[model samples]
Target: MALKTYHGSCHCGAIRYEADIDLTQGAGKCNCTYCLKARAWTTFMKPEAFRVIAGEDHAVSYHKHDQAPVKFHCPTCGVHVYGRGDADYMGGPFVSVFVATLDDATPEELAATPVRFSDGLHNNWQNPPAITGYL
Candidate 1:
């Protein structure tokens, strides 16, 4: 697999980060409560492959009850850029970045990226939702 360096930020530019992602490996689309609300189109990578390039002080983490994925967004822009997973089921130590936040990816790059759907809404993350049209 080949890793591509990507740079991204929140809507208002309050938070900036860089990540190394292997888009050919595929991304994820989930129907979880939070992801649904945010319309998250995301890709996962090792935490070591991602870093906050700026505005760390402006970062705000949003935890959903006892969920393992801690979503981090820009406090100023309220844009969810990425999340850190700590649960084994989530493949611990992973960073899930919202592809929409990727500022440097070309339209062609995103269009060509493969995606997998997940049924997070039903707590069945290992499998895709029955109807993926909404997700």
Candidate 2:
């Protein structure tokens, strides 16, 4: 698929951003606790590919269990939008955007693409599984 432009924001529109991504590559939806709870769908992109057009101050971060990755969220509405980490953990030097937050794309647009599931819940680094049947 060709690369497409997308725009998204936090709940209440406090934080807004845009990205150029290839939806055909899809995203990762882990069964991890936080992921399951938030129902986060993620797509990886280089940090430079994503731009925070507004509300940078409203953004807060969380790091757990010594994991170098830092999850960024909107403090006001508590939306887990994306994250950045070491090259290895992120599949390279990139930030993984929560596909759920991309406002320009509809759920159908997301469902139409392929997604690879990483065993983030089990903390398995190698051999990540492909998730199926998730809406």
Candidate 3:
């Protein structure tokens, strides 16, 4: 998968960022409480692959529980931009960037990428859904 730089912003343009990603790598869907409410389609990348270009001051962080990912959102429009957590947790130091925020994201590009569903609702990573509906 060849990597490419992509730009994105919150719905209200309060939070902006850029990421170097390989769209061929697909994205993730988790059934966790936060994810179920946010409905964000995300992909993980090293912290270096992500950069917050604007609105750090307006972004709000939410941690559901002690070990949950620190999900960041734009307070103005409530768009979930990304999440960060302990370097060792979930194979971080990584940032979970929501692909829907991409400036140029298209239905074709999304349809081309696979969606892997994780059973976060049950804390079961051992068995994830093998197939899911396209985004």
Higher-ranked by lDDT: 1 or 2: 1
Q: Tens digit of lDDT per residue, candidate 1, span 60-99? A: 9888677648889987778989988877876777899999
**Stronger candidate by lDDT (1 vs 3):** 1
Task: List candidate 1 stretches off by more than 4 Å.
Answer: none
Q: What is the lDDT of every predicted structure here?
A: 0.89, 0.78, 0.81
What lDDT score goes with residue 126 in model 3?
A: 40
Q: Per-residue lDDT for 1-135 in model 3, tens only?
A: 768888999999989999998888878887767777788689889888889999988999998797677989987898889888665646757788888899877778878987778877787644565444522
TM-score of 1: 0.94
Q: How do these models rank on lDDT, best leading?
A: 1, 3, 2
**What TM-score number comes out for model 3?**
0.88
lDDT value, residue 55 of candidate 1:
84
The alpha-carbon lDDT assigned to residue 80 of candidate 2 equals 84
Q: How far does residue 132 in candidate 2 sit from its true spot (Å)?
A: 6.2
